[model samples]
Target: MSSQPPEPPPPNPTTAHGSDRKLRADARRNRERVLRTAQQLFATEGLGVSLDEIARRAGVGPGTVHRHFPAKEALYLAVATDQIRQLVAEAEALAASSDPAALFTLLSAMMASGAENVAVKSALVAAEFDLRTAAPDVAADLTRHVADLLDRAHAAGTVRSDLTVEEVMALVAGAFAAIRHIGAETSRDRSAHIAQLILDGLRPHPR
Candidate 1:
């Protein structure tokens, strides 16, 4: 008796597409892991940390990091841009909230984030990579979120009446510079205090 092997099942496009999507999702996650690890290392270990070290810390292969970033500058830009995207997400959440003090909360987070990543930001600046120019869409999205929060604060009388979104953005940049200037970037308490002073200045003054 000739026993013919069972016919192979027909290819399923749906299953193939699902597998492709999963692969893309995994790649996105790996890239994000590299970005976060690079960001922490750059901030704590300075910009001298190697990509291989970042891969080891991120639990990915060196090849993966290289495949995604290619160079330190690319990783630097990705880290900085990732930080801003996180802030934009936070701002979006705050915008959805009914809390009147969301603006201050969001601002505090922004300052803390900037202080934490001051090293990376400085490295990018040294490399002449302005995030506003490099990642304009994400940068603009964050700015828009800040503007929305500022408007809400104005209506709620939470922030100063004279304050504008540009000034608020400038204050964040200034906070980063001040954190770097006093070498408080590594000192959470000191950097926070500086941010607090800046935030306090944004409050409505009692006549």
Candidate 2:
């Protein structure tokens, strides 16, 4: 018999959607686990910590880590990217209030996170991960907010006129290391102590 128009391929719309949704969910969970594990290990062990270790700790296969991050640099950038985004958001939010203490308050919070912050920042710098290249928008946003906060505080006579955001970042990095070595039992105590010291240094003195 003459063949009629061939039947179209069977539609599996519901099955396709279900499979895709489940896949997306699994991917998201895997990525989050990898990121969390990476953050912890990188902070604790520096950038030299292997991807294998991260994958193992995350309870995923090496293939999974690679699936999420094509390369180690990408993973490192992702971590720093998240950090910079947070820092930018914090600066912008605090700047909105124009509270003279906002800049110092932000510094307190940064130091409060302890040397993990320092180590991560250090690793990124050491790895030469270009913030502008990897996450230009967030990096530029962070820079802008930082400049805004420092300039405003300086103009208001709340902060030293000669002080710069560069100085503040460097100072916090140093202070974080010191507090880590101090080995305080409580982060609250450590944070407060570091915060006060930083604030003291940032205070405007009579010329």
Candidate 3:
């Protein structure tokens, strides 16, 4: 025999669907783990953390991260997209509330969520950052969701009618950025306090 190592065994002969399903399930778990790890790292270490580190923390191989998110920007977009979906859903749930003040409450709650609530800003990341350009569909969906929330509030006579959805999103993103920046240097929960102040302005005026 040659000095080379023995050849690997042949592939399994199992049905395609079974293998596909198990592979899909494993992929789903790996994706969730990666996203969760990424979210944690983005919060504690900021967004500059590496994919290898995230995979390690998530108990998966680097390949898994790459398989789910081909680029760092892809990973960032996924994490940010998930966050936006959640905030938009929460905001929509309060759409029919009798108390228009609840709209500001929703804003405060979302703004105080810190890194997780930074999705709106993340969605607006530069065209070079794989946020808007790489995923125009996602960008559109995010814009629509924000518009829905603003429309609901405006119809309820809760928030300012003149304000655009982009403006509101920026305000909330600004709160997330402020807290992240402030909390980076201090031990305080800067978001909660700052969010309250922001809410003061977002609240309805009797006029």
Q: lDDT scores for all predictions?
A: 0.92, 0.76, 0.69
Q: Model 2: how far is 129 from its true place, Å? A: 3.0
Taking every candidate in turn, the Cα RMSD to the unseen true structure, in Å, is 2.8, 4.4, 6.4
Over 4 Å off, model 3: 1-15, 95-102, 113-127, 180-188
**TM-score per candidate:** 0.92, 0.68, 0.70
lDDT per residue for candidate 1 within 1-207, as digits (tens), equals 899999999989999999999999999999999988888888788888899999999999999999998988899889989999999999888988999889899999999999999988888899999999999999999999889888988999888999999999999999999999999988999999999999999999988
* lDDT tens digits, residue span 1-207, model 3: 659889998777677678999999999888988887887777667667888999999999999898888877777777876665665666567655656565576676666554443542443465346445655666566567567667777887877778887787788768777775765313335557787778777766676
Against the true structure, whose lDDT is highest? 1
- Model 3 sits at a Cα RMSD from the real structure of 6.4
> Cα miss at 46, model 2 (Å)?
4.9
Q: How close to the true structure is residue 172 of candidate 2, measured as C-alpha lDDT?
A: 71
lDDT for model 3 = 0.69
What's the distance in Å from true for residue 81, model 2? 1.8
Q: After superposition, how far is residue 190 of candidate 1 from its true place, in Å?
A: 0.4
Task: Extract clashing residue pairs from model 2.
Answer: none
Using TM-score as the yardstick, the better of models 2 and 3 is 3
Report the C-alpha displacement of residue 154, candidate 3, in angstroms: 2.9
